[model samples]
Target: ILRETETDVLVSYLPVGAEEATKWYVEQALTAGCAFVNCIPVFIGREPYWRKRFAQAGLPIIGDDIKSQVGATIVHRMLARLFQERGVRLERTSQLNVGGNMDFYNMLERERLESKKISKTNAVTSMLDHELDPSDIHVGPSDYVPWLSDRKFCHIRMEGRTFGDVPLNLELKLEVWDSPNSAGVVIDAIRCCKLAMDRGLSGALIAPSAYFMKAPPVQYKDDKAHRMVEKFIADLMRMDPDTARKVLNNEITAEQAVQIFERLDPETARGVIKAGIFNVEGLTPIRGAAKVAREFGVDYGKFTEEENTYLRGLMFLFYAWTRQNTPNWFRYITRNPGGFLAKFLAPWFAVVLWNNTIDEELEQSLPPWKRDQLHLITGYKDEDGKDIIIYFRGAPFVDALE
Candidate 1:
């Protein structure tokens, strides 16, 4: 179909957590010289390995879950932000969504809903600067009622305390047509990918993915991401498609491209994009290397290019797991930097400084599933969809790696 139609982009509106099917589509897009926009919860854009692949292939990509314009997750995120800004201590919150479409029916199996649950829960919790306990927040599809036929009903409850120890609570019930809720957002995502292709840009589109998807490769505050998207479209609109491509290929040098994006002020960088001063002719996405380093708060100027890339990959991997497992630790590191194991103290150089520190330290401390594996897959019961465990006291580990 792609060869016959000359399709340059592939949009996966596949059902949530369709990992096996999505993996095939990913390969197909790469083989076909096509961009990919994923609208499901199974991760791709957020994964370092795949993001690097798409970038290396010079293909634009966005994912991992598309967000509805006015759905439960978005609403809950806004409320969470509101509570924070207003000096209210948000204690706990939960969102329950029920829909009657086949989308909902497929999700009735609890085991199949892991990614969906994580996507929704993260969308809300990310709004607050403080840590939200896993036990205190719940967000996911609750049940399916066939008679309602494509309509979704969401219940959101928030419990918080305001200044002076006063209790505050909010309860909201949202109803919308499930099928059409995300259509507009997906359409906009399609246009953005086309724009990236036209401008000779590839890899993860950091801004559009944040505003339009639940699990962007880089998560920005919703308002900031929205502003960036607006600026992105407005800036790109000033250049003709062919001229944009020409500028990308001919007008920019790699050094200037990295400086214009990674070192320049945000406003200046957008102006450069608008003025057609930056391009990825020799550079690529996450822009081959620099953008990833800068965006993730690393200063890689002193490091060699290869060292920078390797370090960025490590940071990216660390962030991917930290986003789910140890958000508090992640927050601590990002916010205060010097609070790990020996606060107000230092590792003794005299005690033992060996090359073994790198491998020996992490290998012993991190869980086997995390340290030794590249990917982890869990099985689901055929009847009810609850998770299935596969670990044993002395089992081989190769199967877990895949």
Candidate 2:
């Protein structure tokens, strides 16, 4: 069917009872050159062997389990985060789910529920900062009710202690249509897989998987996962085929690709600068000067007389006397200098030494004749009309007198 339809993506909604069949289905999907979206609790996306096989085949795969739009797992995870953020120590939690769907009926075989339990448990536990004992958190399908039809009910409770050892507890009851709860999430995941295929992207997509799946290839905080997915979608929309290829090949970042595209439009380039995207400090002077010249169409060499004079004075203040300084030193000062005068003198001259014993030792080490010459050159005269050396280290007078 995949070969005949030329399917771009394969959505796996198989039940846990068909666990052994998933391997054959995955192999078939890979052989058919279809991107795989694992919507079940099986561990294809999380397993290293399957991930590497899909990556080697150059096909994108997303998921280990689908997440509902507003399901019991998400509510429990959010409440856990709230408790942690409010300085409450979460001691124990549990979620009891009852549904009438085939999913719930299939889960009646407890032997098939180990993965489901682990997946849902980790979905909530990952939001916590502290370790939770395995016995403390219970999350799994509790019962099956034939009369409820498609309706599913979830009861979640969290037990914790607040400051001053005050006990705090929360309980929530969620009623949702079991199948439809995850239908929207599965659709979004399929679309993400299709987008990755269109962009020639291979391997597990971290952002979409983290945002849409219960047990993804990698887990991230919900807010961070949302932002990553947003950026991923925005990048796909902004990048052309070649740019997308470059990004997937690790040649450039999404921001760099955006900049490359923005540079083509002079107005956008100006807007980017105005928005302070590239107006950050610590940029190379030459690069900053060139950007200004190129964007505004100004000739840097043809400055006005006042501007030229100011520039000359600035250069003199920055680099007037450095005979022994390395080229790298000048490059470093050009980007990050303590003071303008520090560029011309030794790098250590920028700092004021506060050790009187070191100052005295330095003074005693200087030859009397050189000290006299240093004082004479610097024009230093005490009340006795004698040359008095303050500190000879890192001083311009030392080189001048020498």
Candidate 3:
């Protein structure tokens, strides 16, 4: 509606899990000739088709998701990095996230949760070098507690080796204000998108996305991502000399330039930089196809092999990284069948696996016909000290339970 009244840019602050609606809005923005800044977990900004569309139309766009300034993901990622750098043999890890928001409410549906899980899981998993089985690592939003409002709590646990055979563990709990936690970062993202418009940059902004999002088109270390945002901000200042000078002289607010640029046409926006009408700011000139895409308004470059390699490498690393840290015996059982069978043959393995100390307790209770009819039960001690019985649907014998 605003675009019909001559709005030039559309900055969407959609919540998570609104994948289809977010795409619909992006299409609406394109039809309106308004540039898009997608601040959500939907895949549009990172996907090739939409990126190509925006680039072709010469419309600026930034992001698939916004990262909180000092949120749990970064904190956990930093700790994981510390463990890896300090040579800890990280065996297993999990993050249980709880939040109260419409976003959190929406996520309870489960069906719309795939990308959210992927984004959060990959954020932590990308940092590791070793492979981990998918089962060993548990990283997902665990629950929604309504009383918390926008407050979210995250519990992160890691288990690994210290030096010799010494065991080490890490546990951290983070409580934060969710929507407000991300607002400041979105401010920077808006600036970055506007600057990208002015400079004519497009498709897969490596630095800005890495710094300000949980899932970027590519992954980089936190420090590198920070450096990239700083560089982008500096470049934006240089692209507008009059605004730069005004801000330097304290004659105009930086917010004023932001508002003005938000209204400029894509061509006029690009002209401001090409005419050298603005002072060149930023730590380095924007390089890579992101710059080309912005300038030409079309991402001619295809996704590279390096990205695929990184994705596979990160997934492999995560699968190997967290396996040993979990308690399930299935992971080990599949790996060493010979040793496992030997252990199972010994009486010790049976006792240890089943916790059956009494010899009589190990005896079969059901006859063949009764066993086949599912008339099988397990015995245990209740508080009353009498034999406690639990029935099973399938005829699982004592030996089979082992």
Candidate 4:
């Protein structure tokens, strides 16, 4: 039927006891060139052998166990994460589910239930950072009430200790239509498979599987899984072959493609840089400011007349006191380093000390006579090697002056 219909995806929701048969069906689908979406608890997608075969065949596969849109397992996992994040040590947890679906009836055979139990148990326990004793966690199908046909009821309980050894616990019940609870998830998984096929992608799709299945090939945190799925979909939808080719050929970057698509002009680009709206090569703000200034034909190191006067006044104050009573001030500071006089002199000393240290370091690094020639030039320089006065200037302040 898959080959005749030319199906894009084959969704498998086979019965619980048909694990062996399901494997055969998956193989059949792959052979028929149909993308597979396993909506049952079988290891076909997660198992290495099947994954390798599917990759070799160049067909996308998703699954292990289907996840309901709002299921007992998801709820339990979220609550467990909540407890751990809030610093509550979860001492015990359990999720009991009762349903009247064919699935529930099949699970009546305990032999067919081991995989389901493991999948559901791991779904919750994986969210916890600490180890849990096998005895402390209970997660599996409980009973089948035929009259309730397709209705599932779930009871979840969590017991934990908070600050001061205070006891806290949460208990909740959820009632849902068993089959339809997962129907939406199956539809989404099928669509993801179709999307992968459209993109000429094969093998296991990590994001969709992680978001939609209980036992994905690779597990991810719920939020991260959600984000990955979002990105996957966005990438699929936004991918332009021409743009992608250009990016691959080094004609433009992915970011530049986005900017071009947004119709960004040079003026707006400059504004974005000046407004600190973009990160350039992981440059620090000071260095970034210098780069921007150079791009805009501005002097990064050019101090205003007012700033020069202030700096000159500070220099004069330091020189006057040092020339008049150097020995006495040095002795006072040494005796009472935390004193107001010492505190007052500290900033001036720091500036001169740092300047001299930088000068000495530069001189030592350079050849002997070149150091003297280099000392003839002070302040900063542009890329063109023109001398420019260097001063600290905030972008907002510069903008205000403009």
Candidate 5:
């Protein structure tokens, strides 16, 4: 839909566990011709192939992780930054996060937990303009408790602080609902992506990623990043007279306008059609030849029953001419009228051509004995639908004429 919807940008706030599915989403966006902003920890925005694809599509993209307004990643990053900036040697830090949501349930699959760890770990570590060893930091989702519902609670601890080589400690606890906590940030991302598309800018967007995500390609302070977005939006609004008018009236959907432009591209339109992601009218139907071919693997022009009739005829004749042990041909003939005519044309020792069909006049013109034999073979009723029957010498002919 990113394409045909003429979307300037698409912001994906997919569930946490949807890594592979997110790749598929990116493919759809690229194929459909829309800017993509990934707001999940699926690693696509960070991965080179996805980055290259976005560049090739000429669409702006940002993100691999979304941050809540006051969530764990931001708070953890702040504490980590405070320690480094204050000249206090950091000893240890840990953020234990617990949440109840489908995102949490999916993360229970530890095999899918790698990117999440990388995201949470890097969010804090990246804050220090200097390097920190692996043993010093502890991050990632620790547990899922069903009773909590959508509420998420996080405990952040950093054991370091102050001058004079003094021993200091910090412990913080936070709690909030998971989905709503991130919705505001997601909304901001959506608008930023739209703004990028409006300017015909493509590839990864740095500003929003730095401000709004836990793990952007780069990092920036929350307040600084927020100011940059506000200024960019203001400038973009000024350039578009129509958007400016909307802004004046307080009637603009900053993100939606971008999507409208994206959908107008032909390639994106076709992707929307193929994915059935968008519902439009008067496209091709999934019926008749198309349906049969796709579902049954049977091509209409190749090996249809009528097309293979001659081969069918040969099979029938092979049984009959050799007088092989076979079931009654008449029984078979009665069951399949089309197959009967198909078989009767089989080439063998005899070949007959007749212009007239077995009508009343033709039947009456035959000799009486021949008529009687034909009648008996056809149960005293003409096989070809003539109602004529003949009694011969006061005895019914029961033997096969062949």
Candidate 6:
């Protein structure tokens, strides 16, 4: 049927927890040379085995679970991140969602909810620096409200300690149209999948998945993921075929981009450098520190104290990531250290006093992205350095910014 319709991408919106059914659909897509967008939690993109299979077949797949634009997961994530950014120690939190949709009804069965629980839990917890005991952080569907018909009501409560160990608590409720809430995001995911196909890229598209899916293989901070999505959308249209291949290198296609990413130790620094937005080349990863500021422009004058501090922390993180992951990357640090701390840290001391970030900064429950795992540290170039595009792996569709 897909072949007859000339389907370019196959999106599976099968019943929740239908792994066997989803896998069957995946095989159909694979057989038909089509990209896939898995909207339900069946682990096609998150699992290494399935990812490898998709990469070898040269097709992109973007999800274990889809994230609605401003849906429950995203709201929880943003609020949780607020606590972290504000120095509030999140002690306990729970998100109880009740909807009138059939999705809520299907979730009544515990057997179908294992993956759902994991997906929702991970989506929110991935933002925290502190680890919550399994019992402390509760995230999952609660009950079905037949009268609410496609309307979801979410109640959230957060308990934590503030400065001087002062007790602080927050509680809020949100009501949204369950089905329509995901329409924008799902449409965007579909478009992104098509974009990946057009580029001849395959496997789990890190940037798109991170921004649009709850259980992407790699989870980046939402702000960063948002920028990555912007760069991703524009990057492809700007790059020619050969150059695009050089920059985006989907699914470890070449293992490394020694071509322009410049090898530090092909063994230790097992990662890909994406210069799609900046359109520059041969830039040291050190200067990548000011990426957020450069990309989004943190107006020091306009930024609140909290915003500046966050930006500073992000810049500092870029420094530590470089020092720990690829020390030799310093060869070009003198070029551009970024506007955030260009004068204070650049030529020498920027990386000196940097402390390590918590591992929870990335994935904690699932496979953490180690040096051996395929890592795509995508960002824009702060300046022009000849038009050079590269990729070892691949992606899928949604115009997130749109």
TM-score of each: 0.62, 0.66, 0.59, 0.62, 0.57, 0.63
Sort every candidate by lDDT, greatest first.
2, 1, 6, 4, 3, 5
* Residue pairs with clashing backbones, model 2: none
Candidate 6 all-Cα RMSD:
18.5
- Candidate 1, residues 100-188: lDDT per residue as tens digits? 99999999788889999988888888888888889998899999999989999999999999878999999999999977899999999
lDDT of 6 by residue, 1-402 (tens): 989999998888887888899999999999998999989988999889888888888888899788987788999999999999999999999999999889989888879988888999999899999799999999989999899999999999999999999999999899999887888898988898888778767888888899999999999889999998887776665433433453454312222222222222322122222432112344444343334234433223445544444333333223233334442233233333323332233223212111122223222322222324332222223356321111111010011101
lDDT of each: 0.66, 0.68, 0.60, 0.65, 0.59, 0.66
Model 3 quality (TM-score): 0.59
Mark the regions of model 1 whose C-alpha exceeds 4 Å error after superposition: 240-402
Q: What is model 5's C-alpha RMSD?
A: 25.3
TM-score for model 6? 0.63
Q: What is the model-wide C-alpha lDDT for candidate 3?
A: 0.60
Q: Which stretches of candidate 4 lie over 4 Å from their true place?
A: 240-402
Instruction: Count clashing pairs, candidate 5.
Output: 16
- Highest lDDT against the true fold, candidate: 2
- What lDDT, from 0 to 1, does candidate 6 have? 0.66
